[model samples]
Target chain A: MEMSAHNCRLVFVVLAVSGCAPPDSTSEEQLRPVVPGGFDSVPVPVHNPLTRNKVLLGQQLFFDPILSLDSTVSCATCHRPDAFFADGKAVSRGVGGRPGTRNTPSLLNIAYHQLFFWDGGSITLEHQVFGPLQNPAEMALDLASVLQRLESIPTYREAFEELFDEAPSLRGLTQALGAYQRTLLSGGARYDRYKAGDQTALSPAETRGYKLFKGKAGCLHCHHGFLLTSLRFENNGIAISKEDSGRARVTGLKEDYGKFKVPSLRNVAQTAPYMHNGGMATLSEVIDHYDQGGREVRGKSPLIQPLGLKEEEQADLEAFLHALTDTTVLAGIEGP
Target chain B: MNYRNNIFIAVNLMVLFLVGCDAATSDTGSTTLTLNLNAQVNGKPLSTDPGTTFDVNGTLISFESVRMYISEITLINSNGDPVSILGDGLTVPAKNEDDEDISHTVQDHIVLVKQDAGIDSYDLGTWPAGKYEKIHFKIGIAGTNNRIDPSQVPAGHPLAKQTDYNNHWNWNAGYLYLRIDGKVDTDGDAVPDDEWAVHLGTERFLRQVMVTHDLILEADQPGILDLSIDYGEFLRNVDLSDPDQRICHTMNNLPVANAVANQISSAFSISTDRKRTGGSTSADG
Candidate 1:
C-alpha cells in the first residue's frame, strides 16, 4: 500500500505508541536512546519491531561477507562504521572491483529517513536491502540464493530459529538488518550538546558559523531539523546533462531532472567525499560549491543562491560542519 | 497461546487473506490497458543534444528538458460508456485559494516523459473486454488535483512532494501542468542565445485531449494503441522570437499556457496500423 508522508508518519506514531508488538517474555521493552533536542521520535514500522536478539543477528549479518555471492564483499565493505557508515570514495566499489554511479550514503540516523537511496526509489529500509544485494556490482546475490546460503549455515539457521522462532526467511533477514540499522543513530555531536542547553559545547567560531548557516547561507531551508535534512530531493545543480535523471528517474517528472535527496549533516566530517556523486572530496569544497549557488542547470532549487561568504566565514562554516561529528555512535560498532 | 505463537498465527492469517484477494482479482480475467507515450521533434525522435537545434517557424531552438503531467484518463467504450482510469486512491490536500481534496487512484493515471528516458509506457490497469472508441485524458492535472499542496500528499502519490512530481510550484501551490525548458537561437549561429522556459499550470491551464479511435479488446487477449506527441507541433504557433513570449514561469502568463495547451489537445492520434488484440494503448501526448 502506498502511504502519504503524513499518513506514513501517523502509521509510525501509531505503531510506536501501541508498542509495535504485544508484550511477551522475550519481547522486552527496548527503550529508545535519548536523542538530541529538536529530534523527532524515531519512527518504527509495525512488522519489524526492535529486539536485542534481532539487532545482534543483524549486526553479524551486516559484517559477514557470506551474504555476498563471492564471500568477499559485505555491507561493511562500503558502509564501514569507522568512516561514519560511508566509504571514503567518490563512488562505492563493489564485487569484482566494479564501481557504482552514486556514492554510498551514510547510514547514520537512516531509520528517520522517509525515503531510501539518493533517487528515493525504495520506500522502506527493508525494501532497500534487496537493491544492493541483488545488484551485480554490489553483493551480486539474488534473494533466493542469499536465503538458501544463509539457511545452509548452521550458525545462522540456529540464530534465526532462536530469535524469530522460524527458519531463515527473506523477511526475517531484511527485518533484522533494518532493525540493526535503526540503532545506528547519532546524537552525541557537539552541535547536539549545544542544542541541548550547553552553551560552551561549541567554540565561538563554530557558533558564528552556525548563525551564517542558518542566516546568510540559508541552508536551514532544506537542511533543518535535528537530523539536518528535510529528506526531500532537490536539483542542487549537479548534473549538466540528462544522463542521470536523479529523482526524476523514480518519479518520471521532468522538473526532477538532476535532483537528489538532501543528505543529513550528522557526522558530516567523516563521510567524504560528499554529494550524491561524491564529486566534492572535502567539506570545504562542498561549502564553496554551495556558496557559488550550484551550477547553471535547469530545475536548480531556487533556495540555492550565491552567499559570497568571505574566506574567514568559509572557514567558520567548515568548523561548524566539523562540530557535527558524533564519535559515540562509532563506539558501539567497535567490538561487533 | 504465547505471544510469539499468537503473532505468528496473525501473520499467517494476514498472508492467507492477501493471497485470497489476489486469487479473486486474477480470476476475473480483466484485460490490462497499457498506455505507450513517445516524444518526437518534427518527424524524428526527440534528442537531448543541446547543440541539435530544430527549426520551429523562423527561429532555431534546443530543448534541455521537456516534461509534463498527464492525468484523469477516460476510455469511451463502443457503447459510449466512459471508463475512468483511476490512479491509487490517495487524497492530497488542496493548496490553492479554494481548498479541496485531490484524489488519486492506483490505476496509473499520472506519467512523466523525459527525452533521455526513451519511450514511456504505463499499465493503466484491467478493464472489461470490449471495444473502445475514444480515449480522453487531461494534459495537466485536473483543477481538484492541481491545487493541492504537494507536500501534504502521501509519499506514494505522484505529487506528494515537490521533488516527487517535479511539476509543482511551491510558491504558487499548484502543479506545473507542462514544463518545457530550453534555449532559442535568434542569430542562426547554432548556439542558443536566450533561455526559453514555458511553465503551464494553475486552474485555468488544465486541458483535456480526446482522440477518436477504434480500440478493440478481446477476452484473454490485450489491445494495443500507439500514440505520439510531436514537439514541433507543440511549438508551431508559439512565437519564440518575441522576448515577451520567450519565458514564462508562472500562472500569471495564461496566454502562453493556453497556446501550448491547445497544441497538446491536438497532438494525439490513434495509430490504426499498431492496433492489436491486446489491452494496451501506445500513444504519445
Candidate 2:
C-alpha cells in the first residue's frame, strides 16, 4: 500500500515520539516494527526484543563516560546525535585524542544493516559494540573493567538489577546499546515523500536530478534500493595511495586490497565529509571527483569513468541529494 | 446456506477462474527481440587499431578505444503505440570476451553496450509475436537508473566487475555515456600531435534515436533488428580542428559533448540489405 508523503512523515514522527517513552510491561507493542516507505520489516533478533527499559538503559550507558578507560569519553563523543550519529571529522578521535584510520559512519538506520564498519568486519550490531569499547584509540576499556565500574555505581547497579534481575553483564550491556541504536531511524526525507507519490515534493531541478541519478548519472548502480546502499565492498579508487588496505586488512587478499563496504546514503547531508577516508569536504567535490572519473589506480572498479556533467546539472544533483535530509531525524531527541 | 445455493456459487467461481486463465493465456505467446550493434567509418568497419586513420575535416585520427551505453528501448506497434521492452527494468550488457552473457538487472529500464565488443546483440525480453516497425531507444542510460552504484549490481555483471569496459565514474556518480579516445594530427603532419579523448556523460548528454525498420517476430523465434553507427557521420557535424571541441575528458566541456551527441543521433540507423536508412533525432543539448 502507498502512503502520502505528509502521512508518512506524520507516522514516523508519532513512532519516534512513542518509541522514546520509558519501557514498561505494556510497552511490548512498541517493539513491533515501524518500518517506513521502501523498507521491509526491521529484523529483530528473537533473543533481544526491543523494550523501553533496555533502550533507556542503553541510552544512559551511551552518554555515560564510564565505558571508557579514563572515564572521559562516551559513545556520544564519536557518534553524536546532533551530527546524525557521526562525528563531523575525517576520522573520528577516540579517548586521549587518538585518531582512527577510517571515518566514523553514521548510525542512522544502522539497525537495517547486516554488517558494520567500512571493512564490514563486524557481523552483527551486538558484535560491533565491542570494537569501540575495546579499541585502543576508542574507549580502551575491557568488558570486565567496564562491568566493575558500572557495578560500583549505586544508580547503575540498581538499574541493572531492576532491568536484568542481575548485576551488569557484558551481554546485557551490548544488547541494551544495540536496542537503543535500533530505534535510531532516519525517515521522512523529501525523497521519501517523492517516493510516496507526491509529485510536488521535489523541485523541478531535483526531479531532473532524480532522473539523472537513475539514468545518465548511474548512482543507482550501487546505491540503489530503499536504504540507498548495496552494503557491499568495492574499490572506487579512493585507496589509490595504498595508505590503507581497507577490507584487505581483514581478509588479507590481494584482490580485496582497496575494497571497502558501500555506505548507506540516509542522512548523508548531515553526515560529512564523505567517503571512507572522509577526504571530500563537500558534495560538489565528491561530484567533481566522479565527473573526472576516479583517480587512475590499480584495482579501481571498471565502473569509474568520467561523467562530463554540466555546472547546472551538478547543482541540480546536489540539490536532489540535499532533499534527502530528514530534519526530524536531526532534532536529537533524547528519551526521559 | 442451502446446498443448492452453495452448488450454484461453486459453479460460478469455477467459470470465473476458467475465464481468468483464458485471458492470461491469450497474452502468454512471447518472442525475443534481438538488437544488433555495428560500427562503420567511411563505409568500412570501424577498427580499434591505432594504424587505421580516418580523415575528419582534414584531420587524420585513429581511435584507440570506443564505447557507449544504450538504453530505454521501445518498439512501436503497428498502431503507433510504444511498447516498452524492458521488463523488470533489467539491463543486459554487451557480450564479453569469454562469450559470457553478463546482464545487470537493476530497478531501472536500460542496457549497457560496449562498442569494442564484437557484434553484440541484446535479447530483450519476450513480446507478443507480431510485426513491429520503428524501434526507439536512447543512446545513453537515463532516469534514476543513472546513479546506481555498480558494486550493488551482481558480482559477475559487467558493470560490477573491476574492468574499464564498464565505463562508470564512481566518484562522479555517473556513467561515461560515450568514450572515444584517439590520436589526432591537427597540423596535417605525418606524426600525431596530441591524444584526443572525447568522453561525454552527465544527464545532458543523453540522446534518443529512433529507427524505422520492419521487425517480424514468430512464436518462439527471435527477430533480428540490426543498427549501424557510422563513426564518420558521428563526427560529421563536429569541427575537430577547434581546440574547444578537440579534447573533452571532463564534464566542463559541454559544447563538445553537445556537438558529438547531436552527430551520434544522426549517425545511427537501420541497416537493411547492406543499405542504410537515415534515421536521426534532434538534440536538445
Candidate 3:
C-alpha cells in the first residue's frame, strides 16, 4: 500500500488507542526495546516524521541516478550495502567521470551521527542529505533542480502521495533517507555478542585482536562508543598540506586544521582505503600510519602517539576489527 | 477509509473535543503597521543600476545569486526589557526573479512583489493585546534564521516569486550584510576588483535583525510609538572615512560589519525620528 494511506491507517489505529492508552503501559516487555537497547523509539525529527512509504521511496531514490546533474550517479553509487554501506572505490567519482577529492566514508550507524561529512559541517541527517546534491563537483545539481526532477517522476509522485499528500520535496527526500539510515544499524557483531555474554563466539585470533584494540594498540580512546567511534573531529593526519583544512575551513579555527569526523567503526572491515582523503589503501597501512604518530603533522592530535606493536598485535587488531562485521545484516540489504 | 488507517480522523476528533471543551478567547486591540525598508546608501534613499550594479554596490560587487531565511523579532520597552514576536519569518531575495525592481521601473521586476515585507507587528502573543508605549526594532536578521528545514523555507511563498539574473547572490546571502567593495591601495590605486565579500549568517543568522526599542501607544496618548533606524548614524559609526575601515572599499573589510554588528546589536535606543527620541540626543543622555 502507499505510505500516506498506510500512515493514515496507523494514525487512525494509534489515535483510537491513544485515547484509551495502551493495554499496559508499564509492562516490562513494553519498556524493553524492540531492537535491544537500540532505537530511541521517538525516531528522527518530529517535523520529518518517519513512515514506511517515504522510507521505501527514499531507498528507490538512493539507488536512482536521476538525482544527479547527469543521470550517472545516485547516493547508492557510493554507499552500496554489500560493501558495508561504502563503495570500495579509493575515492568516489561523481558525474562526467570526475573523481572526488575525499574518500567515500561508510554509512553504518550513520543515523546516530550528530554531524555529517569529514569536518562535521552538515548538522542534521535531513540537512546533510543534500550535501552531495549541491556540490558542484558531486551530483552538480542545485537543490531546485533536484526538487523539480523529483516532482516530475511518476513513481516519485506516487511515493509522495503514499508518504505525504504534498508532492516531492527536499524534506521528504531527507527524511526518507534518514529513516532508512536509522535502520542501517549494526548491534549483533561478534564483539557485541561477546559483550552481551556469548563468550564462545570469537576464535583465538579474534580474541587477541579484541585485547589489542582496547589496550596496547590505543584504538579505543577515539573509537569508543558502543558503535565504536568517539564521533569527534581529529586531524587523523592524512592531510599532506594545509590547503584542505577540513574542520578548520568550516569553523575558521586554526587548531582544527585537517580534522575530520571520527567515523563509526561498526563495519570497518568492509570500508577499506580509509581516512578523509583516502590516502592509505589498506587497514594494515592505517595501523602503521597511526603507529608513526600520525605522520608528525603540526596540528596532529597528541593522542595519536606511536604504538610499537609486533606484527602479531597488528594482525590481531585487524582480525578484531573484522570480527565487528555482521555478515547477516551485510548480505540482507542491497543499498541504503 | 479503513478505520485502522485513519490517524488524521482521530487527531481531528481530539482537536474537536478540545474546542468543545472550551471556546478559547483573547482580547488585544490590534493595529497593523507596514514597514518600508528603503535600502539606502550614504544617507540617501536607494536607486538601482540597470542590471549592472544595485542600490549601494554595483557589479563592482553584487550578490548575483542567493537563498536565506530570517526571523525572531523583539521590541524594547521604555525602560530596558524586550518583548518578542515569533515566526515573523521568511526567505528573502526569492529564488527566481524577472530581472527588475518593481519600485523603480514601470516595466516591473516582478521580484519586487517577493520583497521581504517585514513582520505584521499586530499578531497575537506579540505585544500585550492592548495599546503600547512605542515600537522599536533592529534591521539585520535574527541568529536562529536558517535552522529551518529546507522544505519549510516556503518554496511557493509569495516572497519566493520572481525571476532573477543568473546567480545573483543578492537575494540569498542577505542584505549586503557587509557591502565592503570599492578599491584598495594594497599595491597602489583603488581597484574595485580588489574587494572581498563577507556574507555572514550560517543558516542561523536570521535574515531579519533583532529590534528592541520602546513603542509609544496608550489608550490615552499618541497613535503609536514607531522607532526609526537612522542609516546615516549606522554608516557614520563604521569607518567608511578611513581606507581600512571602508566596508565598500575594494579590499572589502568585514571587520567593519562585525564592528557595526557589535555596536547597534543590543545598544539600540528608541527614536522619535532621526532628529529626536524620548528626550535626548544630548551626548550624555
Candidate 4:
C-alpha cells in the first residue's frame, strides 16, 4: 500500500499529462485552478499527500488560537486571508504583543515556493510550521505544548485520528496545516487570462508595464517564470543591520550576507509594505528602489543598476503588478 | 516384534532432536540491554542540579544542561565482525495515507542523552545474547537521517519537533551532536559569573568512539554497558575566562568547534564497575 517517491512522482506526471486533476487534491472537488499559462504543477512532498479531510482539519487549525501559548494568536493572525494571506504591516505582532523582526509574507501560492521564511531557513512547509509556533516573537508555544493543547480538543483529536490515523501529533498537525496552505492557490488573474489567449484581459497601460517588466525594467532577472520568482536568494541591497545579516544568519557564509529570498510578485498590490523588513511602504516605493539600483550594501547583487525609468514607465509597471492580483483565490475558504 | 521395536526407537530419537533445537534457540535469543551514561568531573560524579558546582582549574563551574545525540551504534564480536544493535526499524508515516504499515528505515536508531531531562539511560533494543568485544558509536547523526524533515517524525522521537529540548538547527543544518552549557567563575568569587556554551554539530564534526571492554549479554538477563563521561576532560584546554573563546555554536568559529569535537572521543571511557547501572557509588551529583 505504501508508495515510493519515484512512483508518486510518476503518478503526478501522468496526472499532469492527462486532463484529470492530481490525486493529492486538497478538496473533494478537484483544485481545477486556472493557473497562468505554462505554470508548472504544484510540487507536493511525496511523504505528506494532500487529502480533503486533512486539508479541512488543517484549515480549521490554521484559524484556531489554541496553538498559541496564551490561546490568542493563530497562524491567521499574521497571515490574514483578506490581505492575500499577509498582514498589511511592516512587522507582525505575535502573542503577548511581541513584535516580529521581519515582515509577514503572503501564503498565497506558497506551494510553488521551494523555501520558506525570509532567510529561507526551512526547505519544506511542514518544517516551516514549527518556526512561528516556537519563535518567542511569534505564536510562542513549544511543539510539546501545542500538541498537548490539540490533544485536549475532542474535535481535533477525532479529526487527526481520521486523517492521519494517529493521536494529535507533530506530523498530523504540520501535515494538515501544510495541506490547507497548499490549497490557497492564486493564478486566475488577468495576467494569466491574457496569457491564455484572452485579448481583453489587460488595459493598454498594464500591457505596456508587462513589456517593461521583461524588457527595460529587467524585473525578470530574479522574478522570472510564471510564479514571478526565481525562488533563489539575492542580496537586493536593502540596508543591512548588525542584528539581521539576512541569509548569512542561516548559511554561515560571508558572501551570503544581506541575501534573502526573492518573493513572488503575485498579489503584490494587496500585500503592501514590501521587502524583508517591510521598509518600502507602497508599490511605487518598491519600483523606485529598484530603479535607483537598490541600496549600496555589502554583497549586493551585481545585476542591479540604475534604470533611468521615466515617470510613466514606473506607473505602468505598478499597473501590471495590479493585474497579477486574483481576488477569487479565497472564494471557497471561509474567513477567520 | 523386532520391526515394532526399531520404529519406536526412531520416533524417540526424533523427539530428542526437536528438544535440543528448542534449547539452542532459547540460548541464542535476543535480550534488551540498558546503557547508562554517568557524567563525572575529575573522577567525581557530576549532577545537573543548579546548586552543584565543581572546581575546574581553580575556578568553580556549574553545568546548566548537557544533551547529545548518539547514533550508528554497533557491537564488535571477538571475530572482528560488527553487529548492528539498533536497526529494528523506526515507525514513520507512509507516503500514502492508505498504506497499511508505517514502518520504514529512515535511519539508524539514535538516542538522546540528557541528564537534566532524566534521560541518562537508553534501552538498547534486543541483541543476540553473546559477548561483544567493543562498543562502537558515533557522537552525532549522519547523512539523510540528520536532514530528515523534523515535522514528519513521530512525537517523542529524538529528532521530532516535539522533543523536550531544542537540539536542531535550521532545516538544512540538522541536529547538534553535543550541547553543553555552563557558567564559570572568572574572578574566583565562586559565584560563576561567566556563561559558556559549547555546541558541536554538522556531519564534519561527527566523531566515532570505540571502547574496548568485555560486554556480556545473557539470555533473559539484560546486560548493562555503563559509561563514564568526564566533564573535566571535555572542557580541557578551552578557555572559560575570555567571553569570545567560551562559546562555540559549531558554525561561526571553526577552531573552537574543532577543539571541542576533538576532545569528545577522549572524554568517554567504559566503566568496569556498573556504578550508575547498579546504584550510586561515587558522589550522586
Candidate 5:
C-alpha cells in the first residue's frame, strides 16, 4: 500500500522533469526516473510531473463520483479492483445503464500504454481519460462542468486546497487523475519475475507456451516486449468490421480499414470478450482466430498470417498466457 | 526546513548561475544568419492548397494527415573557393502540426516541400558561419530519433494526423522510409492506365539519398541555387514501369526499393536556375 504511494510521488517527479529526460529509454533500466517512488515505464508526459499529493488528490477524485452526472459512478465503478480495473462483463454498464462500444480494457500498466483505445484513436492516456469522463454513455459529465462539481464538494475543495494551495481547476483535475492512473502499474507477474532473472518462476507448460509464443505461434508479433504489446494495430484475422470501423476510423487509410490496436495481454485471462468488438469470448477462440489467417478484409495487416497451431500447442499457449494473470492490481485498490 | 537543506539550495542556485554566465560569455562574435524558407508545393504556393493534397495511387494512402522534416543545413560560401557554412541549426518546431502548419510540411509532402523551395531558409545568428562552401544534406531521419514507441507521435503532433500512417513495417519495428506512387505504363501503353505505386522503406534499402553540389554565391552576385528533380528520369531510371525489374507493392517490394534508391539519389541535380530545389513537389504523392 505504502509502496504505491511512493510510486505515485515518483510519477509526479518524472512528469515535472520530463523535458529533461530522454523519451522512454534509460542508460540502464535501474537508473529510471524516480517517481511516486519506484521505477516502471518512464513516467508518461514527464511534463505533467506527478506529486504524491497530486496522485492522492487524484485518487480521491477517481472514486468521489462528484465528477459524474448523477454522482453515482466514479471511474472506479466499472473499473473495479477485483477485475484488474476492468469490469468482467462482456460489456461494462456505464452511467445510467449506458453501454460503451468496446469492453473496458484492463487499466493495468496503462501508464506504459502508448495508444489509449482499442482502435488506437485516443493517442494518450491523458487524452483518453476525457472520453470516459465526458462520454454520455460513460460517466456522462462534461469536463467544463467537472470543475463546478468538484468545487461543490467541501471534501474535494479542501483536498485540492491542501495539495495545490489553489482551488480546484480543470488542469488540477486532469493532473490528479493522470497522477492516480500512473500508479496503476501492475507487474510482478510470472513473466516479469522470469525476465528479472528468476529462471525457475515458470511452470513447464508455461515455459513451452512462452517458447511457442516467441517462435512458431508468432503471438510476439503483436504482443511483444516487457509491456507485453508492441502496441500495434492489426485486423487479428477476425471479422471485426461489422461493429467498429476499427483503426480505419482513426487513420482514414483503406489498409487500416479493419485494424485495431493490439491490446496488451498482461492480465489477458481475466479480461474476456476479446477483439476490438469483443467478438471472441475465450482465449482458445482467439488463438483459433489467428490459426486461420484473418478473414479477407481488403486491408488486413500482412502480419496476420495463418499459424496452423496444433490443438495441444494452442492449448499450451493459452496455459502460458494464463501465467500473465495478476490479481493484486484488481483487488482492493482504493482504501485509506 | 533544515539549515543544511537551505545551504544546499543556495549552493545549487550558485552553480546554475555560474553555468549560465559561462555559456553566455564563451560564444561570441558571430553574425546571425536567417534564411526565410519559401516552398511553393504542387505548382501552388503553400497559401494555395486547402491544406490537403490528393494522391491517385500507392500502398493504401491514408491522406488523413501528413508532415515532412529536413534539417542540418550546411550553408556553402560559394564566394571564392569552397568553404563549408556551419554554426547552430535550430529545428524550431518539436515535430508535428500543433507547432504550426509548417512543421508538418517538413515531415509530409515529401513529394512537394524542398530545402529552399519547401524547406525555406536558415539564419546562423548572422550571415553564414564557418567556411561557407558547397552544401550537402539528407532529406530524412536524424540521430536523436524519437526512440520511444511511436504510438504517441500522433498525440504529440495532432496537426498532421501522423498517428494514422501505417507505412511502418510489421516484420521489423521501423517506419517505412518513403512511400512513392504514380500511374505506370508497365506494358508501355500510351496512357498511364496500368497503375502501380512504389512502397519504399524498412531497414534494408532506406537510402533515398538526395545531395547538393557546386553552389555559387558572391557578395554582389545572385546566390539562389535550385535543384531540378526530373520525375521523368525518376520513372525511367528507377524503372517504375517494368514489372519484372520493378518491385510491386504486394506488402513488400525490393527492386522498386532499389530503383527508387538509385534514381532519387541521382535525379536531384543542383542547378542555378531556380531559387530552391526544383519544381514544386506535387503534393499528391
Candidate 6:
C-alpha cells in the first residue's frame, strides 16, 4: 500500500522498539516519532508550520524564563519533561510564588487536543499561549512588555526574523512556543505494543485489568481514543467550587457548571497529583474516586457510576494504568 | 468685442460640462458624516481621567476608564430606508494561513468607543446628501465578533487583544462589550477609595439603542451627529456605595451586570446638530 510520510512514520514507530530518539541528540528528520503510535493526523495548525528551526527556537523559548515578569519561572518549570510534562504538585506556583487555581496539565501529546485548559476556555493552541504569560498570578508579564524584552535580545530577535521573516511579534511568540510543544509526543507504552499485535507484551493481570477498565470500570466512555481522551468537556462530578466554575466560565451556561476537558491518559503514571484542582494525589486515589462515582455535585455526568471492584481488581487496574506509561520518557530519572 | 463674447460663452459651457448636472443642482451629491460622542455626568461634561469625581447615588465616584463597543449602525432616511455605514475595511489577522484572503469583517463596521483614549469621533463615511428621520446603533458587540480570535489580530486594531485596555477575557473566550472601571467613596470622604469594574458582555447582555433625530445633510458638506451619554443615568438604580454592588464581570456578578445592561439605552441621548448651519437638537444634553 502507498503510504504517506506520516503513515510511514506511524508504521516505523510501531515496528521499531525504540521509536523516538532522545530529545537532546535527535536530528530534525529523526524527530518524526516523538510520539509513537498510529496517530498520523497530528492537528498542527496550518498557520504555524512545524519546521525544525522554529521547533528549535521554540524549545529555547520554552526553557527561557525571560517570558515571565520576574524571569524566574519558565514553561519548563510547570511542564517538566522529567515528570511527563506535568509538575508533581497539587497546584503550580508561578512568579512571586503565587498559587494557580488549577493543576498544571501534562503537555505530552498536546497536539491531539482540540481545546486547551481545564475549562476549555481557549479554542486554539496559539490562543492559549497568552493566558499564562499575562495572568497576574502566573508569569505576570503583559504581551507588549514581553515583546519588547524578546526584541531587545539579539538572539531571539535574529532567530525570529530568520524563521518568521518578521520582527519579534505576538504571532512569532505564540507560533514558536506552539510548534515546540507539538513535538512533545509520547507513545510506545507496553499497552501500545500489545495493541500492535504482540499478545505477550502485557502480563496476565494487566490484560485482565485492561478488560475491566474498558468494561466494568467504564473508562472507555471518555478515554477511548489512541491518545486516550475523548477531547470533549465533561462533568465527572468533581466538587463544584464557585470560585472556579470550570466550563461554565467559558460557555456561560449554568448547565455547563463543573465541566472540564477530559485530559489524555497517556503518561498517566508519571503525571501525579491528578484532577483539575490536583485534589487527588495518586493514581490509586484517582481510581478510588472513580470507583465511588466521584463527589456528588450539580451538573455531574451520569456516565460516572459506582464501579463495584474489589481491592485486588483495583490494584490490577492501577497496574494496568502503569503499563500506559512510556518507560523511555522516564529512562534516566534517578530520584522522586 | 465678438471674440471676447465667444470666449465667455466657451467658459460657461466648460463649467457646465466639468461640474456635471448633479453637482450644479447640489441635490444628488454626497457628503461625509461624522459621529461625535459627547460624554457627561449628570448634565456636566465628563472626564475619565483618574481623580475626576462625579456624584453617583450620593457617592463620589472617579472613573479610571469608560469604553464600549458600537456596531451595526444604520441611518434611517425621510423615506424610512436604512443606510448601513460601511466602515474603512479594517481587518484583524487570519485564523488560518490559507484564509488570508478572507476579510476579517467580524470587527468591520464596528467602533470601539474609548473615551479615556480620546477617541470619540468616528467617520461614518460619505453618503447621499439628504435628510434622515433617526439614527440606530447597538451598544454592544454582536455574535461571532465577540468570539473572534484575538491572538490572530494585530495590535492597534479595534478588536485587537490590547485595544480596549485588555477587555477580552482569556477564560471566557469573549470580549467585554462595555467596560467601566472606577473607584467609589464608601465612607463619605470626597476622595474615592473602593475600586469597581463593571464589565458587561456575553450574548445575553447585548442592548440595542436608537436615537430619533431630524438631521439634514448638505451636498459635499461634513455633518456631525452628536451623541451624549450620561453617567448619572447609567448608574440610575445601582448603588455603588454598597460593597457587593461595586464589581461585575458578567457571569461572576450577574445582578450588577444585569442592572448595567438594563440601563444602557436610557443613558444615551442624541443631538441632531447641523455642522453647516451649527444648529442643535432639543435632546442635546
Compute the TM-score of each model's chain A versus the native chain A and list the values: 0.90, 0.89, 0.85, 0.89, 0.83, 0.88
* Regions of model 1 farther than 4 Å from truth: A1-34, A162-166, A240-242, B1-285
TM-score of 6: 0.85
> Who is ahead in TM-score, 3 or 5?
3
DockQ of each: 0.03, 0.01, 0.08, 0.28, 0.02, 0.30
Q: How does each model score on lDDT?
A: 0.70, 0.69, 0.52, 0.76, 0.53, 0.76
Docking category of candidate 2? incorrect
DockQ of 1: 0.03
Instruction: For each candidate, give its TM-score against the true structure.
Output: 0.54, 0.50, 0.67, 0.82, 0.51, 0.85
- Please state the interface RMSD for every predicted structure, separated by commas: 13.0, 17.5, 11.2, 6.9, 11.7, 4.9
The sequence of per-residue lDDT tens digits that candidate 4 reaches over residues B1-285 is: 999999999999999877645422334467887888877887778876767788765567888878888888888766677878555456443222221223245657688888767666897777777666777888998866665666777766777763456787653347878988888888877788778888888878898887776666777787788888887777776777766777888776678788778878888887645642332222110
| Best by the TM-score measure | 6
lDDT of 3 by residue, B8-116 (tens): 7899999977764421211323333323233333434332331232323221222222222222334444434444544344432111122211111011111111122
TM-score of chain B of each: 0.77, 0.76, 0.42, 0.80, 0.46, 0.79
User: For residues B1-285, could you state the per-residue lDDT of candidate 2 as single tens digits?
Assistant: 699999999999999877645321224466776767668876678887767788876778887767777777777766677777544644423212222223334643455666665546765666776556667777766745554434334333434422344365432345677878778877877555678877777677788887776666667877676777777776776677777677875454567777788877777766644433233322221
User: Which regions of candidate 3 fall more than 4 Å away from where they truly are?
Assistant: A1-43, A193-200, A238-240, A250-255, A333-336, B1-28, B43-50, B54-59, B63-72, B76-83, B88-196, B202-285
Q: Which rank order by TM-score, best down to worst?
A: 6, 4, 3, 1, 5, 2
Model 4 score (lDDT): 0.76
* Candidate closest to the true structure, highest DockQ: 6
By DockQ, the candidates rank as 6, 4, 3, 1, 5, 2
lDDT of residue B108 for candidate 3: 11
Q: Write the per-residue lDDT of candidate 5 for residues B151-170, one digit (tens) a residue.
A: 22322331211312334332
Model 4: fraction of native contacts: 0.52
DockQ of 4: 0.28
lDDT of 4 by residue, A119-211 (tens): 877757877888898888888898778888889999888987777678889888888899777766777789888888887899999999999
In model 1, state the lDDT of residue B257: 69
